[model samples]
Target: MTGELREAAEPTRSEGATYYGRPVIKEPVWKVPDVPAYLYLGGMAGAAALMAAGAGLTGRPGLARAGRVSSGIGATASVAFLVHDLGRPLRFLNMLRVFKPTSPLSVGSWVLAPFSALAGAGAVSAATGLLPRLGWLSSSAAAVLAPAMTTYTAVLLADTAVPAWHEPYRELPFVFAGSAVASAAGLGVVAAPAAQAGPARRMAVAGSALEVAATRRMQRRAGMVGEVFGQGRAGRLLRTAEALVVAGSVTALLARRSRIAAVASGLCLTGAGLATRFGIFEAGHASARDPRYTVEPQRLRSR
Candidate 1:
């Protein structure tokens, strides 16, 4: 029988054994409204910070302004989502109480604190024409920090026990980085002037290409756990994200001379990024929900 037929004929249990419907791995308690939003916004802000610096250096004032605004807003939203996830805003302070080099969350909190301030300062300076020099300094600093800000979330997710997430540790960082770039580039394509949006359009294409490649690689290497990404709701979302990314990339290439095409491509890429994030999250959730994912992997590992 084919894999799909076998799956249809049998429940997602390991080798005719069952765990009495109990999950072998505990499901993540992280709320959907919070963690996925944090991941998306944090990545968008990080990529925007890099774009802001690049645009400023290249003398594209309009694009720079768009990047600055996006970085600040995205950073703020990311923090809000994190705080909401924690259930108490004040609990965020505990994250700063110490620095643990081994802890991705600890490192992320530190990175976010300064990144948020710098991005905010840059945005304010652009908006109010105040402290231009300081704004330049902040934007520059943010650019340096932005890469870590975007990629550390991958480390955070990979550090987890969930098979779907932890198994693809090598590729998740690149996947997230690509998604971040695509999202920020999409924002620029939508908000920046046509003349200034050239780099953004190029970035959107490049980033989307990287995201698609990395995701496919991850799925291929994910072994039995990879099935989660191809089944049920997660599969639908992943398929949708892939379609949108392809469509957006093609539109971006063709958008060089058309503002309407640029806008449409921007919307498509942004939606693709969102769908990708949610799909990954749901895949992890589904993997944890199924005992086979947890048991089968370990059973193989022990041999």
Candidate 2:
């Protein structure tokens, strides 16, 4: 352990002690709003693309159209946020030069580029009523790529040195997948007609359940690093997300029968997704900013 935090940590080493009023590690340089927004939109768009593809193949044209449009917009916006974080569009393109399966950043860039193009093209064709076969094919391809898009962010975060993020790698992917599904479903419920929204409402309920379960399990398994999730700003946002999930899940059950219910459920689930992304981001930062979380977890693992 570093000298500055050694004394502070000694008194309560089991609990990771404290920061001793000084940061023990170099904080992440990722920007606010940009990174968090990218995370949120990437998940939403990925799941939306998957749902859209399924709808298209299953004869649910309205739902498919809505999903394609939402995915296209969300994916395009997600790329913008990611590019903004990189500080240059060319920097993002540079990452595409090598297909490094082991590098999350490189892999993510590759997955993102084609997924965005196909999803966007699918949306365009759906909207203009041109090339229906090609649009369906494009959406199907995007769907194949969507699972990676939704869960890859979790993998990316887990690869980081952040205590909270890296320690909970196994659970994070599940949480991300569920959140993505819920967000995509929320969009469908909001945009699709009631007759065409049945699948969406069901998806929302299922996804919300998975997200809530995986998140709770992750917290319990996170050990002391998990404490950050329930403290300060992170706590508030996560609690709010949980509340919203519960409310939204219940509301979704009533959605197919009532437009008002559908709208409310959609907003709540989407809002929960946004809040979860920000909250998880904050928790990772908090864990890194305080050295105890990092040092202690490593200490225990080394033993």
Candidate 3:
């Protein structure tokens, strides 16, 4: 990301605070679809790698193969979105020059770079039935990196000045992890046969539960700043996401019995994941633009 920010309006004084309607911090200049899509896809890919690894261990070759393919595609698309947002592919490469543990972006770049390559290599080999050793190695490596890939974005976002993201840092990762799990399970359910889909259906339920719990906790803990997630565009998207999660989890029970139900459940889960990412993205930006979110939190802590 450019990290460039939009200028806020001039401050107007009121009640000993820069009150009324104005931003206290600069809003992100990140464009639409690019950043949000990147987050969603990256998380999904990360979680998919884990599922792929699990399936491999349990002798479910079909699910394992499908997960590898799904992970590869998601990772590839994620890189594309990141590059598009950066406005140049070379910028991403530059980030790999050094590993900065303190900087989520830097570490994320390194993680994504290797993870994508390995996942892609694994997917190709698994699909084409070539380079079996290379496929096993790369896929195994990717799974090791998947947890980081899935959650570093939450850290990156919370590290920012945006109150909606920063104040809820403690809970954001759980929400994101759950979102990723659900999305990965969605893919598994859609791609694997009914007999091989039991694990995926269980993941859908587990992920949905975790996501809902974390989201609720985050919002409640955030106090006033949390309002951004419950109002305007963010609210609409989040509500939709939660609804989809409910529908998908419920539908997944019937998925093993019917292909149509599996497709429907998968769609709902994926939609929920997409909507959750975008909704969180929107909430962060909205919080950044509002002075109250930045000011009120500090004010409360001082008391």
- The numbered model that scores best in TM-score is 3
Q: Candidate 2 on 103-197: residue-level lDDT in tens?
A: 99889889999999998998898889999899888888999999999999999999988888998899999999999999899989989988888
Task: Between candidates 1 and 3, name the one with more favorable TM-score.
Answer: 3
RMSD of 1: 5.4
lDDT of 3 by residue, 16-103 (tens): 3646566889988887899999999999999999999999999888889888998999999999999999999999889998998889
Off by over 4 Å in 2: 1-21
In terms of TM-score, how similar is model 1 to the real structure? 0.93
**Deviation (Å) of 259 in candidate 3:** 0.5
lDDT (Cα, 0-100) at 80 in candidate 1 = 90
Candidate 1 global lDDT: 0.89
Clashes of 3: 0
Candidate 3 collision pairs = none
TM-scores vs. true structure, each candidate? 0.93, 0.93, 0.94
